[model samples]
Target: MASTILVTGGTGTLGRHVVPLLRGAGCSVRVLSRRERPDEDGVVYVTGDLRENAGVAAAVAGCATVLHLAGGPKGDDEATAHLARAAAEAQVKHLVYISVIGADRVPLAWLRSKLAAERAVADSGVPWTTLRAAQFHDLTLAMVEKMAKLPVVPSPGGLRLQPVDAREVAERLVELTLGAPAGLVPDLAGPRVYDLAELSRGYLRARGKRRPLMPVRIPGKAGRAYRAGANLTLEGATLGERTWEDFLSERVA
Candidate 1:
């Protein structure tokens, strides 16, 4: 494969970590973003919005590999389809994607979008690989921080999370991007799992704050899925080294 690689969402949490590592690997990195950014530190910035199918073909042109990570609360399915189609037209060699762990099992709109995005890439005629990873420490921190802001935090009963370090996920993604496409490899999760209560308490303790956590049930199929641990990968998965507590100590402390 050529050394030039295009990374979508190269400004987000995981992308921030992945770009530097790719640069260190002696690969020329091209980042596509909605807004224009000046090129710096040997990285090229291309202005494009994947959601609107704008500048996508130009972004994928002449790049051997495309590391797709751009996502949002919605429209990921459509955006990924746009990217995949463009990549196929450009005759790109490989397309690597990052998806959430419960994408296939969770009864949520966002997860459904992710699953559709996976399908778009798989059927795009470009060789592809997909990694289903747990929530990142950064995202978990954001969640708990918001919860701690409330006078009484509503802890959803049976809702658990296995938060992994974004850097570790980044490293693994870089390894996959450089190598051959392996369709749907094992899930990647944190070293340990923590329930919603435990996660909230950890955040509260880290920030030297206290809040009463009221147990609230998530209604319907989504609730049942959470209670059944459908979001978890207990077996046949790759586990990260960092724990939720490890993240709290460094970030919150």
Candidate 2:
């Protein structure tokens, strides 16, 4: 019998790629969504919301592993806690969590929520692995587009980022699911770091547009931490093969 794995947020950005990869690896995948899709090869769509304990429990029943990737913009901590509790009740053999790189050091509210979620998973008493990855390259491009529409792109000055590929991050998570559930693993990053404005410029250039880039100095602990490079991966991390330039080319071409 193939090992059953339940992937929360299985229709999401990363999940779309992950679902196919796990299926190719011969794992029976059950995706938790708000609505079910028709049966497909190696895939089962289960409808449920992570915010509901009963729903989460039902979705996770009889699964050998659970990949907790469903997170909200602000209430992720609460939602993740509920999922962790449900995973514990279901006696899941392994729980794999996808988190951000600066979750521990950054002072952003979203990052704080992710940290709380990580803690909840650690305390859930299930064998688990938490994989922290740098900002996704797609996220960076989205940011650029949003900022470019504004009068100016407001960002902390002197901030650096190691934007990683979402596909690479998904690959690492799949690898973790097939292996022993270790504790926190090394952060995953891109091959190089780039400044925010430079990255923004790269995005504009890719689309054959030019926009005035203005770097703003944000106040508070979050701004200071960003300027201090708190989001960068230190040592013992995996570097992705695709560079920001390569990512832009792939998208534009």
Candidate 3:
């Protein structure tokens, strides 16, 4: 593999964590972003938008591997396809993607896009790997904060979430990009699973806010899938290095 690695969304949460680790590992990292950035010590900041072919081509060209972390509910499919095509053209050895834990089973809009992106990477003919990780503690806390905006906090009934630390996921991605491509790795999840009410209450306690939780059953197939634990992996899967409470303690401290 070449020494230079291209990282999409290098300024994102996971990217911010992964880029430094990759730099410390002695890899010359290139980051693609819509906005221009000054070059770092070992990171080559290449401004390129993934929506267009030429931009993606510039980012992937001359890079040995790609760690794609830029995507959302909208335009994820298109961007993934474009980035994959560019990587294939550049003969990139590996393309490691960070996907949600239940992309294949969860019916969420963003997860659907991730599942499509997984296909794009696999079908691109470039050796690729995908890691399905649980939601980040930060993200879960953000969700709880949004829920708190409502008059009453309505927790999804029987929804158990395994919120993984973003830093742990970033470390795993860096390790994966350094190794040979291995299709799909076992999911990375938090040490413990917390039900919706419990998680919400934890957040409330941390923030010194008390809100009575109203457990409501989320109706439909997606809710059923969540209630059935489609988002959780089998036994012996959770990485268990960090916990949401730990993350909260750090953030609050």
Candidate 4:
């Protein structure tokens, strides 16, 4: 029988891609979802909420591996800790995690939460692998789309992003989940980097709309961190194939 792998956040953006690939690789997947869901082909759903530490042990039971992907703006550390504790108790063989590139250096509250989540997985007794990736194209697109709604979009100076394809990130994650536990593999980023202004301009062009961009400075230490490119990984990182332009073309109407 194929080993059953547990996937948290299996219905999310990256999870949507990872779960299918895992299934294709002949692994029976058990997804932990907050809402109750019926079983599907080669995959089963276990109702659970990592945040509240509810239904976690049952979800981790009998699984050879646990892919920790459930995350939010906050409480990521707590949620991941909850899952880690359950996995440790279950003696799950492999624990895999997905994190952002600047989790440690960004100086943002949310990034701190992500960094803490990474620590939670590392401290878990189960063997683990964590992959830090750049901002997803989908997320970047949403930001730009929302900004374009205003009469004048505020473009933060020195705010640059290497937006990666979520599918590519998913592919790498599945490879890590299946393979031996390798701690902190190389970071993944997009082929090209674009500033906030450039990204917003691209979005406007794609939508056949125009908006004046107002150059704005990000205030406080967070701004300083961003100005220093703390959120970027320019070297020793695995670059994804899809560019921001490629994603915009396909996603933007």
Query: Which candidate would rank higher by lDDT, 2 or 4?
Result: 4
By summed lDDT, the worst window of 10 consecutive residues in model 2 runs over 147-156
Model 4 residue 216 distance off true place after TM-score fit, in angstroms: 0.4
Tens digits of per-residue lDDT for model 2 on 1-253?
A: 9879999988888898899999999899999888768868868888777666547788888998999877778877887888888889889999999999999999999999999999999999889999999988888888878887776656558789898998999999999999999989999999989998888888778888767767678688987898888888867788999999999999864
What tens-digit string does per-residue lDDT give for candidate 4 at 44-110? 9999888999999999999999999888999999999999999999999999999999999989999
User: Model 3 off-target regions past 4 Å?
Assistant: 236-238
Lowest lDDT sum, 10 consecutive residues, model 4, at 244-253
Q: Write the per-residue lDDT of candidate 1 for residues 1-253, one digit (tens) a residue.
A: 4368999999999999999999999999999999999999889999999999999999999999999999999999999999999999999999999999989999999999999999999999999999999999999889888888999999999999989999999999999999999999899999999998999999899889979999999999999999999999989989999899988999888
Q: What RMSD does model 3 have?
A: 1.5
Of 1 and 2, the candidate ranking higher by lDDT = 1
Of 1 and 3, the candidate ahead on lDDT is: 1
- RMSD to the hidden true structure, all candidates: 1.0, 1.4, 1.5, 0.6
lDDT of 4: 0.95
The residue-level lDDT of candidate 4 at 94 comes to 98
Best by TM-score: 4
Model 1: ten consecutive residues of lowest lDDT: 1-10
Q: On TM-score, who's better, 3 or 4? A: 4
lDDT of 3 by residue, 23-73 (tens): 899888999989988997878898888866557898888888999998765
List clashing residue pairs in candidate 3: none
